[model samples]
Target: MQPNKIKIKNYQLNSNLMLAPMAGITDTVLRSIVRSMDKDCLLVTEMLSSEALVNNPNAKILESNENESPLAFQLSGHKPHIMAKAAKIIENKADFIDINMGCPVKKVVCGGDGSALMKTPQLASDIVKAIKDHVNKPVTVKFRLGWTLDTKNFVEFGKLMEESGADAITLHARTRSQMYADKADWAEISKLVNEVKIPIYANGDITNIKNAIECLNLSKANGLAIGRGALGNPFLFKQLEHYFNTGEILPEQSLKEKIETLKEHLNCEIAHRGEENGIKFFRKFYPYYIKGIRGGGAYRGKLVTEDNYNNIINLLDEIIENEQKILHIHSAN
Candidate 1:
C-alpha cells in the first residue's frame, strides 16, 4: 500500500494516519498510549471551546505531553474573532490548528457551532480565514456532509474552505441529522476530494487496516482521521502502519497482552487525572478492551461501578487467569 504524505503549510507529516480529535476521550493519557504505539501518527487534542479556552488558558485540557508533537489542537466555535484568538493562543503549542465544524451535539449546534457551521458556509469560511490570518501554523476544518440530506453541500463547502485559506479539510461523510446513526456516505467524501485541492482526510467508521484500505480505495482520500474506532485499541495505528509499509498484517494482541496494556492505560490515566476521577473516567473504556472475551459483559458490569483501584486491578488479573484456564482446557480436549 502506497502511503500519502499529508502536507499543510510548511509541515509534512511523516504518516497520513491521524488520531482524530474526540471530545473527552483523546486526552493526554489516551494520546500518550497511541503515541507509544506509533510515533509518527498524527494526534489531535479533544475539541476545546474557544470561549472556554480564551477565558481559561490554563485549563487542564490544554495540558499535553512533550512527545505528542505533530499534534493538532481542535477548537469549536462560531465567532470568527474569538476562534482566531483561541488559535493564536495555541498556535505556539500546536503543529496544526483544527476547527470543528462536524460535531452534531444539540448543545453545540444550538450555539451556532459544530455541525451548525455547515449550514452557515460564509461564517465557516470566515472562521478559517481568521485563523489563517492569525496563525503561522496550518489551519484545517473538520465538517460533515451537511445539516441534512436535503442540504448535502460538502463539495461546495470543501471548495469554499480552500478559497478561504484552509490548509486541509476532514470530511465526516454524514449529514448532521444522521448523528452517527447510519453508515457514513463515503461517496460524498469522494465528491469532496474531487472538488478540493487541499488534502481531504476521510473520517468515519474506519476501524482496522481492512476498513482503512476500503475507505482509501473508495474515497481517494489523502489520509484517515480515526475517532471512535480507536477507543480501546491503542495498537491500531501501529498495526495500520505495518500493513501500509510492509503489506503484512501483524497478529492481533493476545488476551494477556490486552490485559497488561489495559493496566498500563489505567495507571497513566490515574497519574494524569488523579485516582478517583481517573478510575471513574476509565469506566467508559472497560467494555472496549474486554469486548469479545468470554464473561466480558459481566466483568464490564462490575468494572464500570468499581471505584477501588486495587479491586479493578484484581478483577483484571482474574480475567487473565480465567482465560489461561480456558485455553488450557481447550488444549487438553
Candidate 2:
C-alpha cells in the first residue's frame, strides 16, 4: 500500500515521517541537514517554554530561517496567557505550533507543564485553545498516553484536545510512570485513532524500520515521530523514506559512511557556531558515530578529551583508517 500524506489541516508535510524535536539535537544546523536529505519531512524545534520566549524574544533558541520551513515549534507551559503570548511571537516563523504535554522530566512537570498537564486535562485544553486562538498556523499537541498505569485516560485526553481546537495530536504511547521504558504500548495508539478525528503521530522506542512497520500496523497512525533513534544516524530518515517509497529497507551505513557524516556534521557545526564552540558541541555526538566499531571506546575517549578541532578531525581520520585495517585482518584470520 502507498503511504499517505501527512496533513495537519492546511499545513501538510511532504512525508508521513518526522524528526521528533529533541532538547539538544534538533537545532538549526541538524534540522537543516535533515531538511536537505528530505525536502519535506516535518521537522520540529526543541521545546521552548512560554516563559522563556516571553522573557527573551531575542534568545538564540527561537531563531530560524527558510531552510527549516514547514518546521513545527513545540511550546511547553501551563498558563494560557503566557503560552498565547509566546505563540504570537513565533507564529510567523513556524509552520505549526506544537504544545508539549509529553515530556516526563520532573523539573518540567513540577512547573505544571509537560506531561504534568495531562493530569489537569482542562488546563491543557485551555492552553491549547489559547495558543490556537493566538496563532494563525495550525496548533498541535504532543502528549503521552496518561499519567500512570491505572489512569490510562488517553482516549478521553485525545478527544479533549481535539475538542479544544487542536488540529492534530502526537501521542507518545507510554504513561508518565513508564518514561523511556521500552515497553511502549502501541496498542493504545489505536484507541486515539479510532476515537479522535484529528491526525495522530506515534512516538516512542521506534529504533528502526522494523519497529516503524510494527508500530504503524498496531497503531494505524498517520505518521511516525522518531527521537533518540535518529541520533548519530541521520541517514535513518533517508532509509525510512526509501522504505516508504519502495518497500525496501536500506542496509546499515558502513563505517566509512558514518565517519564521513560525522565529519560533515562537525564542519556544519563549526560553520554554524564558529570553530571553538562548534568543536565542543560536536563532542556530544562522537560516541554515537563510533558505536559498534572495534576500539571505539579508546577513540570515543580521545574524541571527548581532545580540545582542538584540527586534532579532533585528524583523530577521526586515524580511527577510521586503523579500524578498517583491523577489521580486514580479523576477516582474513
Candidate 3:
C-alpha cells in the first residue's frame, strides 16, 4: 500500500511527503539522515541567497550529496536577474529550483523578497518567469496566504505562478503576520487548490501523522511539506511513510533509541563540519532532542557552554549513564 508517487514536470518525486527547505536546519547532514530513513522522500536544501550563489565562489552551502538525489535547492532574492543568475549556476547540481516567496523573516522581507513578493503579484510572476526561462529543471515556488489577513491573495498569486510557468506551488497556510504563532488555516489552502491546476503541497502545523492526514483531507492538496515537525525527530518521515503505506500508527521511539539517534545526528554534524564548529552548531538542537527528559535543561545548559568536543561527549555519556540507572531502578520496582 505504498503512497502513489508524484511527478513534477520532468522529475518523478518518489514521495509525496517532502522536507520543507528550512533555512538553518536542513543542512547536508540532516538531509542525509532523513534520506537514509526514507530513500524515496524529497529532501530540500536550506534557502540559499541567490546573490551569494552568483558572487561567492566559496558558496559551498549549495553543495549536494550524490546519495541525496532528487534534491531541490531553494533560493531567495528580490530581483529577477539575481534569482535567474542563481538558478543558472545551480542548474546542473540541483534536480529542481524552488523560489522562496513564503519566508516572513524581517531580514528577508526588508530585502523586498520572500513573502513580500506575495504582495507584489507582478514582481512575483516576473521572478518566476525569469527563473523558469533560465533553468532547465522544474521551477517551484513556496508562498504564504498573503501579506495580511485583509489581503489573502494566494488564489490569485498561485494562478500567476502557474501562468508564468511554475511547475508546482506550496502554500504555507499562514499569513505573513501570523508568523508561526496562530494555527494554520487549511481552509485557505483549500481555496487555493480550487483555484490552481498544478500540484499543490500543503505546509505548516503538520506535527504528526494525524495532523498530516487532516491537512490533506481538509485541503485536498496533492502533497504535504513538513517543517518544524522534523526538528529532533528524523523518524518522523519514516512514521509518515509507514502510516501512508499501512493505515496504522507506528510504535513510538524508546528513550534509549532516542538518545542513540541524537548521538548519530551529533556525530554526523561533527563529521560534516569540524568538531569545533559542529559543537557550536549542534548546541541549538540540544533543547529539541532533550526536551521532557529529567534534568534536560541542565544538560542542555552544560552542553551549550562547553566548547570542546570531548567535554560535550563526556557530558552526554554522563546523561546516558544516569538514564540507565533510572531504567534499572524502574525495572526493579
Candidate 4:
C-alpha cells in the first residue's frame, strides 16, 4: 500500500518519492522534466557550494523557477556562517534549504564539508542550526552513513540534526570510504528510523520500482530518495508512484518509448544550456541511455566527435530510425 504523504513544513509532498540532489545531474532542465512526469514528487537542485553561492557568477544556477514550485536547494560548506548566509540568500527563492553532507568527492571532503562533516558532529550540528536560524522554510540535511568504516556515526548524527532544528533528514546508506562501490547498507538506515522522530528519507542504489519498494520496507523510512535510477529514466517516479498507490507493476519501456524519451531529454538540455555547451554537456549521458544496444558504442563514438548541433541531432535521428527498424524485424521474426 502507498504510505501516507507527510508534511515537511508548510509544504506537503503528495508522494513519498523524491529526486536526490545529484551534483552535475539534477539541474533546472532535468527537474522540469521530472516535474512533468510526476508533479507530486519533491525535486532538488544540484548541490551548490556555499562559497560559490556567495562569490561565483553562476549563482543563478541555484535560483528556483516559479514553475518549479516545492523545489529545494542543496548547499555544501564547512563553515556555519557561510552556510547561514547562503541559506538566507536562497530562502526567498527556494521552498526549502537542504545541506549536503553526503557528497564523497575528494575536493569536498578535503574542505571539511560534505561527507567530511560526518566526522565532525559538532560542526554538522552548528551548520544545521545556523541555516535553521536564518531560514523560515524547512531545513533539510542529506548525509551519508559515516565518514568511513571505522566511524559509522549516522544514528548519533541524525539525533543531533533533529536537536539542531532540521525539519527532515535524508540518509544515503553508504560510508564515505565505500564511495558508491559497495551495496548500500539499509540496516543502518533502519537504525536511524528507529532513533529519530524527524522524517527520514532512505537513499542509495534504488534503481527501479522493486528496489524502491524493498528499500522502503527494509529501512522503514518515511520516504525514498532516488539518484542514479533516474539517469535516463525520468519515468521512474511515475512508475513507483503508480505501484505504491495501486499495487500494480507498470509495463516496461517499449523501444519506441525509450527513443522518444531520449530525444525529449536531449531537447530539454539543448533548450536550457544552448546548442554548443549543451551538446558538450550531454555527451556524458549518451552511454547511459544507449547502453547494451547494438551499434551503441559506434553511435557514442560519432556523438563525441560531432560539435554542430545539427550533426548531433542527425546522428540521434539515424540511430533511432535504425533501432526502430531492428525492433520491427525482431517483432516480425
Candidate 5:
C-alpha cells in the first residue's frame, strides 16, 4: 500500500512500476505514449538480439525518441562476450541493460536463449557477469519460474543472478512450459524475493490496481513490470502511479477518452510506418482499444480488415455512438 522508490544500484526510479519489454509491442511509439501518461515510470525497449546489435549498431529497433530516457534496452542472447559487446554499444543510451531469459517463444528458446537459459544457470550467470564487465549501467535480468512445473528453480536462479552481478530481477510467475496458459504463481515470486539480495520485481497478470496490490502483498516484491495489460490502456502507468502515491483509484477513462487516445496512437503509428503500412500495423490494436464496448467484437472485425484510414475513423465513431447509447440505456435501467 505504500509507495516505494526502486533503487537499482546508483539509479533511482521515481516509481516502482516498469513497462515490461514486449517484443513487437513496446516500440518507440508505445513507449512515448506511456511516457506521456507517466513520466517517472521506467520504460523498457522491446527485446533485441545481441547478434543484431553486434553486427549493426544502427539497427532500426534502436531508434528512440529523446524524451524516453531512464529507458532500459533488453538484449536476448546466450553468448557472453557478444551480449557484453551489445550492452557496451548501447550503454550511453540506456539507464539499465536488461537480459532476457524468460521469453518462451520457440524461435528464441530453440537457440539457447530466452526461457532456455533457465535450464543452463551457469551460462546465464556468465552472461550477466559478462555484461557487467562491459557496461557501467545497472544490469537486470527477467525470467520466468523455470522450464517446467517440476523445474521451478526461480529461487535458486534469483540468487545466482544476484551473485552474477544482476542489480535487479523481474520474475514473471509462470514457468517456461506454462507459456502463459495458467494463472501466474505469485507464491514462486515470494520465494525468489527471499533468496535474492537485489531488487525483485513481480510481473505477470498485473493489469489493474487491485491485482497490483495483491501481487505485491503476496510476493513482497520491490516493484512490478506490466506487459500485455498495458496494450490498449497506456494510461495504466499513470493510474498505478496515482494509486501508489495518493491511495486513490483513478476512474478508468470514459469511452470517448479511450477513442481519443486510440486516435493519437493511430496517428503516431501512421506517421511512423507511413500510410499503408501504418494503417496495417494499427489494425492489431483495435481489440484492445474497443474492449468491453457494446458490440465491439463486430466493430473490431470490421476495423481490422478495413484498409482505408478514413473508414477506420468512421467505424470508431460508430462504436463510440453505440457505446454511449448502451450506457444511457443502462443508466435508465
Candidate 6:
C-alpha cells in the first residue's frame, strides 16, 4: 500500500518515493523534468561541494524554483564549518538540506568526504551538528552501510547522526567498498531502522514498485529513495504511486510514447542550457530513452555524436515515424 504523508519535521511529502541526488544527472533541468511527472514525490538536487558554495557563493548548483517544491540540496564536504556554511546558503531555497556521506567515488572519499566520513563518525557527527546549528531547515544525511565490510559501522554511524540532530536518514545499503558491485543489503537497513528514531529511507538498487515494496518490508524504512532507476523512467514514480494505491501494474509505455517523451526531454534540456551545451549534456541520456527500440543501437550511436539540435529533432522525427508504424499495426490487434 502507498504510505501516508511522510512528515520530516515541518516539511511533509505526499509520496515516499524520494529522488536520490545524483552528482551530474540530477541537475536542475532533470529535476524540472521529474517535477512535471510527479507532483508529490520529494526531489533532491545534485551533490554540491561545500567549498564551492562558500568560495564562489554564486555557484549554479544552487539554482532552483518552487516548481520543484520540497526539494533538498545535498552538500558534500569534510569540514564542519564549511558544510555548515554551505547548509546556511541553501537554507531558504531548499525544503531541507541533505549531507551526502555515501558517494563511493575515489576522488570524493579521498577528500575525507562521502563514504570516508563513515570511517570517522566523530567528524560526520560534528558536520551534521554544525549544519543544523547554521540552518533552520530540517537537516538530513544520506550515507552507506559503512566504509568497508570489515568496518561495518552503520548502526553506530546512524546513531551518531541521530544524536547529532539529523532530522532524517537515507541509507544506501552497501559499504563504500561495495560501491555498485553487488546488490544493496536491505537487511542492514533493518538494523538501522530498529536503532534510530528519525525517518530512515532505504536507497540503492530499488528500481520498481516490487523492489520498493520488498525493500520497505525488509528494512521497515519510512520510505524508498530511488536514483539510477528514475533516470529515463520518470514514469516509474507515477507507476509506483499507482501500484501502491491500487495494486495494479500499469501497462508499459509504448515505444512511441517513450520517443515523444525523449523529444520533450531534449527540448527541456535545450531550453535550460541552450542548444550547444544542452545537446552535449543530453548525449548521455539517449541509451536510457531509446533502449528497447528495434534500431536503438545504431540510433544511439548516431544521436550521441550529433551536435545540432535541429539534427536531433530530425532524427527524433525519423525515429517516431518508424516506431509509430509498428505501434499502430500492433494496437490494431
Top candidate (TM-score): 1
For lDDT, the strongest prediction is 5
TM-score of 1: 0.98
Per candidate, the number of residue pairs that clash is 0, 0, 0, 0, 0, 0
Q: For model 1, how big is the CA root-mean-square deviation?
A: 0.9
Error of 6 at 237 (Å): 0.7
Candidate ranking under lDDT, highest first, comes to: 5, 1, 2, 6, 3, 4
Worst 10 residues of 5 by lDDT: 187-196
Better of 4 and 5 by TM-score: 5
Model 2: ten consecutive residues of lowest lDDT: 1-10
How high is the lDDT of residue 274 in model 5?
A: 91
Each prediction's TM-score versus the true structure: 0.98, 0.96, 0.96, 0.96, 0.97, 0.96
Model 2 CA deviation exceeding 4 Å by range? 327-333
RMSD of each: 0.9, 1.5, 1.5, 1.5, 1.3, 1.5
TM-score of decoy 6 = 0.96
Which runs of model 1 end up more than 4 angstroms from their true locations? Answer: none
Candidate 6 Cα outliers beyond 4 Å, as residue runs:
328-333
Q: State the RMSD for candidate 5.
A: 1.3
Query: Scored by Cα lDDT, where does model 2 land?
Result: 0.88
Query: Which tens-of-lDDT digit does each residue in 275-311 have in candidate 5?
Result: 9988988888889988988787889889999999999
Instruction: Put down candidate 4 lDDT per residue, 20-41, tens digits, no spaces.
Output: 9987788888888788878888
lDDT of 6 by residue, 1-333 (tens): 766657888787787878899887998878877888778888999999999999977776677878998899999999999999888878889898999999999999999999999988999999999998889999999999888888899999999999999999999999989889999989889999899888988998988777888998998998889999987788888888778778898887776777777888888888878889889989989999888788989988999999987888888888889887878899999
